[model samples]
Target: MSRIPQLVIANGTVVNSFGRRHAHIVVVDGKISQLVDATEPVPDAERTIDATGQLVIPGGVDGHCHVAQVTGRFRTLDDYRTTSTAALWGGTTTIIDFGIPRDARETPLEAVLSKKALAQESRCDVALHGSVVRWDETVPWQLEQLAAEGVRSVKMYTTNRGTTMADGDTILKVMREMVRLDGLTYIHAEHDPIIADCTAQHADDGRIGIEHLHRTRPELAEETSVKETLAMAQYTKAPVYFVHQSTPGAVDLVTEARARGQEAYSETCPHYLTLDDTVYGSAFPEWYACCPPMRSPETVAALKQRLAGGAIHTVASDHSCYDLTQKRERTDDVRAMPHGLPGVETRMPVTFTAMAEAGSSVEDFVEVFAAGPARINALPGKGSVAEGFDADLVLFDPSVQRTVDGGALHMGTDFSPFDGRTLAGWPAVVVSAGRVVLDREGFHDPGAVGRFVSRNGFREHLAATADLSAATL
Candidate 1:
């Protein structure tokens, strides 16, 4: 019998959501076989990495991102190859992107299969949250099948109108069905009426500037939708996660619901936590245009405080990369401009630098960015440094500092939202499944060995408290 291949990462401060200690991680067949003390002499088979003064933590799990997604007329700039490479360079070993149907004619299963085909060349692990575009009697069965196939979550929109938004009753029905199927719901919560009314007023007044984009979709719009969805989630007994929460009020709602022992978790992105609406007044405001626009600085500050206090559960990138040419063409009308920013490469460093400056520790970083997201997304073998977990790790050097430059990044976009910002704590080495994908020289594409993770399903803690009586009437 051939001996199992082994690799050891030695002399690093292994950190997790709970704590950190000096340990040597042993990897056998791409799985963590042991976490021994650094002082102990271990038998190493293949290779060893010297992580003398670095912090070793679980690789990032970006639970919300858009790569190769087709939106209206234009497709996203980054596909699996570029997006996954950027993810690895940024210490993200796993990403959960949306699998959206191209049109009404396509079934959810077909959408998922197409997305998986696109992800076949990914340089890092990729999973998908199937989008439910066509809701009918057959929808529940499809959702259950998708869940069983490792797509444990589905995304629903409430503001895109004829494109992807589902009505209130439709959402409620879907939530109820999700409850029965053991599938989780990820919602882009924004009241369509509010946004539409505001947009109509702006158009009537000929105020279609980027500033109007912020005015049309104010914090109240998000708050109203968030509160309403929480109620539906509470009544339907389904676990709902709000994505890209930008307002303090919405975060408060999630916190309050959890206080009531409800099943809810709020996810905020790096852009929302750090950037303010002030960017709308910049020379090129179209570049910063995204749905649920950045909130007031005061709200941003409050969100940071809440994040530190554990009110905010997870921080994701929501990375939707669009080229500068795409954004520039619609500069005359903000509504026509593509929404999103290239963030997969900058997500971890930017957020890490901000929270670290706010006095957050390494453990807090792991909890929110890695472990918490992994747990929420149902990736059992991710987000921790321990035996029996995947050897997906990052060796971070906190002393190194670098300024952000979009042109220098590996992302497909030409500009960075974080340009000129200096950040520390960059991952000097990113190891995915025991293979080194990023090192001192640069990123290396280790072929397409990334696997689709079949998630273990929702956290039973919330399911145990679900109100089954709230099922569809």
Candidate 2:
């Protein structure tokens, strides 16, 4: 018989989507059992975490990331074990990663199951977004099977041709099928033709530096794809989520879609909200390269406003880390450089800093970083600190500030995109499933403590229907 976990976390302000309160939390059998007033006596428990003067919130949920992805020539540095360790230390208790299909023979269901198997090495709970690389008679059936098995979202790409890109017809078909299966379609939106043309133009002009990668795939590429994807979502009566949205134009498209009552939501990354295009002008700009690359500071400011106003739904770390050597291998050639940054461990601190600086409250922090992700992706027992919820908590000190160093983080990387940057609100202690996985010292693996979560919730956040096809763009 398993021993009942008894833990008491005291003298902290419990922040959640509903509200905030000074309370003591009780955990029993890996679930939040009670929230008593702070003035009340501490409950008897085997373990106690003193959270005095700390903001005790539900652990963060990173909804989009690529872990141990091996695609043709591109591969992420950190696999499930290292990624989950980094996430725990960073205050994220759950992460939703992609199960990308590598070949035609691999079905989406098989890919998702294989990915879940790999995540068994994780120390934090993990979920998967199923991918469809090819559209055939079997693809729709595969999507239905995946949804039936608790995979609530499917990832599709409108860019990266010759790799994961799906044509317009394929994208439309997937969206319609997701609607039929009661799932969400997550899209990586970028117009392939625009990217190809821009790449050829830059190459012909002999401008192949790392900065040119961003120049080649400009805002128009993302904006155009988002517009088209929204149109399709409207036509098919399917909800769509655009991942790593960077440009104001793309934001505008999402806003318009929402106004037209299309179930369109988007997630922005820390790099997009905090960093700007000037990184491309830095001496070693290759380190800042990523898909849907960072934009100007003005755009960042606008996106921040939207996020603060709840125009944007969630913030996720598109955390795809490649070794520094891999990044520098093609510093002189923009097209060959690996595109990604080590960000899983930095998402919470960076986002917390952004929100606090904007005068947002801890409730807002819990909503965007935790509850919103759980509600959107339908990860049960996550993203909240209420009774019956998973006892995943973070004792975060908002006043504490620290400079980010990649080598110091648990990810498999040599550098950080936010290196040397100081941010407030660091996680002093982290708990996962009622287990103390991270303390001041470091992470402690709890013997395959992470479980594969099969998600099914797909809550609607928009008006019912408005025939957006006939509406103005």
Candidate 3:
């Protein structure tokens, strides 16, 4: 007979994909087996966690994070161990990180395998999004192979340094191929030509301040790129996802595209919704810098409304952190600093506060943070806390208040843009696969049995529940 480790999370309000309600969740054999009334008696099992007056919700699924990836001369501060530790502390149990190809050396699969190997000892579960650098004939075959190995998503860049931009024909080909394979294509939307033109113009005019970063990129750049990507999605009938959408114009484009029955979805980061161009004018502007630069306060408010109305599907940190030494070097020259922010540990709490301030329900948070990301990644047994789902849960104290301090966070980053800001609703207890990984004190351990998840057989599963109409918007 096999032994069952039975544990009961008693007297807590259970928040799942459906919604939040008071219930006692029973965990047996590392899976949620039953949900009973909050006052239910604990069965004869291993242990019982009293979650009175706390919200027991599904562990967060961070759909976008950059762990152990490098850019230019600066390497990311958080590796698998550190990043996963920070994630666990923040109640995020699963991560979908990017796997960028090395410069002209290894194949996509080879690069993914190397990242997988590096993340083998992660403290939390992980998945990969195979980033396509130079799209070519051989790329499709490599993608198919990656899909076979459980890598279901491919990332294509529209504008970046030293990266090949996929023209219309190439984008159409890749989109069609992904649709045929029942996979997803994630796009970094920014018009290359417009951005190049703007950058050159700004350089010539000597208007290269941190504020000029937004001018060079501009809202039109994002809008044009988003419109183009939506058109391609319509042309090829592929499920398209826009990563880190930053402006109102881009949001409007996605809203219109979804109305047309196109499969277009978008994810906006915390930085875009919280920070703005004023950060660029701050004494330490480099700390708040990122691609698709933050827009005006009006754009941020619009993003908040979109999120509340379900116009936006997902929220991610885009948690890419680099040390101060490298970040400051770009302060003098806005283009030199790597584009990213350190946010894996803060994505959840910050969003929760923002939504709560807007009178949004916990259902809204669950939909955007947990369910939407899992569905996008095609991961089963995740995104929910119902019976038969993985026992990944977070116990939140809605009244707990804390100030954001980057130096105090567990990630390897040296600072945080959100520093000194106070927020409410923090995770008091975190459980991953029926095991406690983080509590009020800190992480349980550095190497606590995190695993690399394979993407095999995910497409068929997603196809069964995929609402093509809902996916596009």
Candidate 4:
């Protein structure tokens, strides 16, 4: 026990999802040692930092990030190294990415394996969610292998039709398999028929451009799809998670299901929480061309209200990095454009601002920013600041602010969705795996590669250990 205290962070307010405490944090071998009371003697350590006025919080966990991800004709520009580094800068030490099959011929297991190999280049820890576009006799075996790989969640689309969508039969069969494996099922919920019909009508009227995106994908489609997916989840008793939920009605459906003893979760992105459909009318409409595009101002406000009410489980960046040129290339046709926004570096500030505007507390922000994602995703060592947890933590001023400049950021993109807006909650110092990765001086990469974290199964681990609702949100 000679190295019992290798590092010490003194005099900071340690914040948790449920509470906060003024304590000194001690670290040993990359895991938290303990939180020594201020009245107690400071534990001897090899290094110590005086964080007099900063808030020491668990490093952020971004559950929806796209790195070097391919979509249609274009691919996101950033790789594991770039995105993870940017995540550290933003106080997010752990990021969960999707292993979606590039084509129908590529097996789900193959996609997950490829992502794991690429994730080795990350400077921060990484986890993956596997995806399936179809169900064959071999899919059950592929899922078993995915669980063995620690990628426990599987994603499917209900709206992409021939390209990425899995029909109702495939979806139900996959949910049953996920339940058998004690894993979670993730759905991109948007009614396929509604979206297809709306897009066709827009095309007929010559209004299928990015500027008409919000109208093309209406909120009713999302609410309807959510209800359908929840029904399936309830029928199969499978734990289901809806990603990038953009409407309050959709979140309410999940909330009501949870009340009925169903395992359901709703995750909304920073874009849906802060930005509105007005971006479609702006000159740079292509910048907001993601599927299930930004909703109206009324919808945005209502979604924020849901988050404040604790109906939303997690707030993710949904970070997709495409340069301005790729976005410009397909501005004329929304269907052909690359979808997603560059916001990994801005998730902390943006979410903080949104919740603050909603009159929520820091404890609530802590819930969505770090704890909720870790708990729902079965990441045991990544979320809390308590003893034996990972020493991935950030020190920051809660009231400090900075205006965003997309070019000045590090996601390897040329623009930001929240450009020109001032935001708070920027990180001052970031520690990951017991190393001071970012501080006032600069970032210290030093050839550190992030580990691929294996997640725990729901029934095998979570149901036996914690409350489902508390663990999820």
Candidate 5:
């Protein structure tokens, strides 16, 4: 490893969500010390990287990554080391994971604390979101503990009953508490009744296979739940963020709420913007199995349109590390299969490709890929290439293209949903916290250098990043 106390990235275009400029970034002690003009004399440093002709953007902030996550009878294969290693490979220097309780017996406080302990194995920085499966007398105290631990957000689901769902009463109660705590509420919105009825019909008709996954979870179910959740957020006046929204209508609901001065945000995954329901008819439908499953091609197009128009706040991987064996275990029944895709390693190229296809600019992509997620999640030190920020930066070449091969990825998965797809904008060099991690030669093992980062309260965080929202909007 080429270790240096002071590193200079010279002669590159600094692309931030706010704007772009040609500058030489100086890194010292894991933070960006300065941004010198390209026209000025290059500052002397212990080592220098010639980033000439490269696009220097802030390292990506993947707000929805599941590392070694346990859900029901299944758990993802990758740990923090594997997941964060993959993140650095893909130019994501920071990742926020959910501390969802493993079961009803496991308290949310224990779940979050356990994840924090495990995060010491990460190769990159990490943050967490607390979760609640039900509203109990002790839940509010648990949430207060999470807030004190710097985990300012909590995630709840409107579906996945008996396993991870929270009733409407619980949801409303959590939102009200989040408001009181000055934190954000993270929700997985999907109308369980709509899904259960449709799925039951499908099962009775012998159509509950992987191929029928998308059909069972109708887009209207997602829309209905988004609206319902928005009502609760509005009543509680809590800043809310919806994860993995697959339909344009759901995104539009959040947009409308935001217009009404409600602090609402919609986050869509890369698979939702790229893959469609047609994959269900493919030879390997199990590869596409996920919650709030991929929508029709028309829906995918509309979601991309929503993204291009700035209605979406973040683009997350929703990365689950199940291999082909686990995926094949329940090929005949989507209900038993572990859902989610191995995507943290490919988020950069896939999102860059999708954004280009949406006719959006590079700066716009940075907003969703890095800035928006960091700000909304309260990780202010991440998602930008500027003075005094963490020296987490990536040098990318948008002109460079590669074909994705699932087996070649580093997310501890054996297949990729986007395998064989030619994508552009791969990262050439990655620096995390002033350390040279990935470059032309290869990855430098950083060990468990990633510590748990604390986040600010949502009210203060949003206020600080308002300029970012205004700039992108």
Candidate 6:
């Protein structure tokens, strides 16, 4: 029989889906078995982590990331190994990244399997969200297959090269199919016609500054796309997730849609909450460029207010890093740069600082970073430190302060948009699935053992449906 490794983390404040509390956690067989008062004697175990004066919170679930995925004309730097390593160092234990199918030849299953092969050596748990590139008669069947393979979510773009830009009918069809399969459909909401026209107009006038990218893809573009997407969701009663919602106006739409009992939700990124369009005027404007480009300070303030007031469901990094050479190539016309920035490693610290500054409780942070993401993705036994849950935990030091340097970070990228900024509150220790992966000094000697979780609960529903379909035939 395999030995059940016993360990006790004592005198730490535990923060879970419920709230923060002072308790001692007992770990056995790589799972949390009990949480009791700190005054109790520390159980004899293989090891004891003395967490006095520290906060122990559930490890983050990064719901949106672009690890090893490629955008048009550019490829990402961090692959599965490097990206998950970086995430562990930053206190995230699980990631839900996009498995985008090749527009030319590959099927969704092939793409997802290929990515899984690449991620087999990861250091943190992983799951994939399939991106729908081609919407045809076979697309619904493909989605069902993906769900069977443990991918419970599918992504569709309203505007992207080589991806399907479905009309209202196609969108409705996809929504209905996804709903019937009991899978979540994530949409990249943006008006393609408006963006194309604005880009052409700016190209003609030679007004392609980094600042102008926002004007080209204005709030109206997002607003209109969100309206149309919600309409389709309403028509089909499909659960829709709006990715990287940036503006206050867009938040209002999502708020209203949720109120109407529609399963419409939105996610915002760290870049939108911190950086704004003015950053584009800096000496290295390309460093701040990203899709759904940064907006005004007013919008940022409104987003903060909305997030604090519980309007926003979750926050993600949306991290996509390219080499510095790729970013600098578009120095002349900011539109030429690859649209993304590095944040997977910085997301936790930055958000923690922001929440502290806003006087928001730690419970609120746990909801957005842990519970909400895991629940939305239907990840079982994750997002908490209760009994029988995986021991994915982070020991945080609220007093420690540090400065962010893009060049010094572990990401494969060569730059960071938040370089030189000091942030309070940092993760002192990170544990994933009962193994200690990172500490204050950096990564430890534990070998990479992360595995792809075949989601059991929600994904099982898809398999059951497939069986029923065959039986009916």
Model 1 segments beyond 4 Å from truth? 1-5, 460-473
Tens-digit per-residue lDDT, 322-407, candidate 6: 87788877766765678888888888988887777777778788878887788778776578777777888999888889999888
lDDT of 6 at 39: 76
Candidate 6 whole-model C-alpha lDDT, 0 to 1:
0.81
Query: Per-residue alpha-carbon lDDT of model 3 for 14-99, expressed as tens digits?
Result: 87556577888889877889888765675545878889989888889998999988765667877898999888888899998888
Report the lDDT tens digits of candidate 2 across residue range 322-395. Answer: 98889888888767777888888999989989988777788888888998888778787788787788999999
Task: Give me the runs in candidate 3 sitting further than 4 Å from their true place.
Answer: 1-4, 446-448, 456-459, 463-473
**TM-score between model 6 and native:** 0.93
Q: Please identify model 5 stretches exceeding 4 Å from their true place.
A: 1-5, 467-473
What tens digits encode model 1's per-residue C-alpha lDDT throughout 390-447?
9999998887898998899988988988888899878899999989888888877898
- Point out the worst 10-residue segment of candidate 4 by lDDT: 464-473
The candidate 5 region of ten consecutive residues with least summed lDDT is 464-473
lDDT of each: 0.85, 0.85, 0.82, 0.90, 0.92, 0.81
Cα displacement (angstroms), candidate 5, residue 167, comes to 0.3
RMSD of each: 4.5, 4.8, 2.8, 1.9, 2.3, 5.1
Clashing pairs in 1: none
Model 6, residue 449: distance off in Å is: 1.1
Candidate 4: tens digits of C-alpha lDDT, residues 1-473: 35557789998988888788888999988899789986677788888987878999999999999889987778899999999999998999999999999887789999989989998899999999999999899999999999998989999999987778999998999999999998999999999999999999999999988899999999999999999999999999999999999999999999999999999999999999988999999989987888789998999999999999999999999899998999999788888888889889899999999999999998899989998899889897877888878999999998899999888999999999999999989999999999998888988883546989999997666653365336534
Question: For residue 121, what is the lDDT in candidate 1?
Answer: 89
C-alpha RMSD of candidate 2 = 4.8
Residues 39-102 of candidate 5 have per-residue lDDT tens digits of 9988888989999989999999999999899888888999999999999999999999989999
